[model samples]
Target: MVDAVARLLRRGLPVTLAAVDPVLLELRGVLARAVDPGDEASRIAALDGTLRGLLARFPDARYAAAARALFGLPPATPGMNLTARRALAAERAGHEVHHFRKRVEPRLIATLTAELLADADRFTHAPLIAPRLAPVSARQPVLADPFAWEVAEQEEQLSLLWSAIYAARAELLAVERLISLRAERTDIVRAAVTAAWRWAGARAEAISYTTAFAPDLTIDELVALAGWTPPLTPGQTSRLTEAAAGGVAREQFVAHLHGETVLDDTWTTGLLAALQSTEPTSPEQPGAGGSSTAVPADPDQNG
Candidate 1:
């Protein structure tokens, strides 16, 4: 499902992410029932049934969109096996769960939706989630009213489908939260980057620090001046670092060391070098100097 969605995004399809919210909310409810400690046998039976129904619906829900996008046709016949369907749903759900507290990329949700829609043809040819191979003659004798029985069966399947969705609700919500945070983080970074660029533009040579009575600022300190946390990726960190380091000469990267204490120039140099390096600096690097002082920024400055 993840791969499919990525492919769709790459294809530039305008898939909607709103379709997933309801699916996730339903999954969360399913999980809630499982977490409850009552009626063990009934719970197991219901869970099994619900999962089976969802295994069908999961692919059906996305197939229409995928088929429409890929072939300009309606949804094709379902063909994926039950196990494959379940695996796809669970795997995608688990990914969102993993990113619950982390910053997710803003484009990820849309990309996932597109990929799922793109795989309509494959899913159409897949086996049923709950295939029926029982003898048709023997099964016919059990029902009093075939039409009523079929209607009831359909209702039950619908119920089970919803149950399956509720089961993974928590994970879906987590993914949603992560995606939201990612957008927020992007905005924050944009503002910070703009500020850094402006600061560098106005400065001549390098931005001096008030280390006269204070200590030298470290790379980590510079990051802090940007006003964010460790949620940033290596690429983002590097971009921020580059923005802050702009216009400053390598020799004057850590300028203005004026404390009574002896400043370790190597520590400052190493940190600046790491920040300026083309490759990302390792987290274990000495750039986050433990004894490094803070670089005071202007009252109105963003960096």
Candidate 2:
């Protein structure tokens, strides 16, 4: 499987990731299961997209450079010859050609293969959760509508949750778009995207915490969630909360995004505060949990 994967990756481009050679059949099967089974083009595109996504998230710069040198992918000169590629890889990996060829190259490919397989599995599987039922009285028809009522015990206000998320994410998307701009630095682009994903993690955590109990809630349960295994820090729930009120984290992060010029954070904080202020008086559903789980308010509001 490893040899087949290596050969297939050597081919690199989506157009060639097919089973023309008998050796690629195993890898093709894996790709088929992970993406659209019918369309060859779609499957190949999915594989390429997954590979790019995996490379982008790699923490170490050396791994990224090695991948580029090994495969003629983005940020790498696809037309480079073999000696040139190895020389580039050696330079980036900080090793002589022999040591890199002997040690680093093999381990790097193995890790890449493992990550690709895991991405396939993630696409194919989802955890199943049992649905909680509503109370008998809660199901009774309203006075105006004799036959209308919801059956689910909990109601996550998806629209409102989505509205706030969309509003906040709009700015992040603008910043990500800056990657295409000639003036933007790669590090700045990375910072913008990381903050965006952290916001997404925050949303997932909020939904999980608020719904884990239709009865009540606690902080300990939330802490038990993200382990060291996930890319995010386990203790980010508090810091995630701080981003709402123009917290220093968001302020500094946004400042960096603006290329070291610190600007007002009301663009985000005001938007978040506006969302939370609309919260219902009583405990609301998950997703857009009661205002307590909201992205924090503007620092001015606190004073």
Best by lDDT: 2
lDDT per residue (tens digit) for residues 126-241 in model 1: 22222222355653443678887766666454343333323223333333344334433233322332333332322211122212211342333322322222244455444433
CA shift at 291, candidate 2, in angstroms?
26
Q: Model 1 scores what on Cα lDDT?
A: 0.33
| Per-model lDDT | 0.33, 0.46
Give the alpha carbon lDDT tens digit for every residue of 220-271 in model 2.
Answer: 3332222111133434433344443232344444333342111112223222
- TM-score for every candidate vs. truth? 0.17, 0.46
Clashing pairs in 2: 245-297
Give the TM-score (vs. native) of candidate 1.
0.17
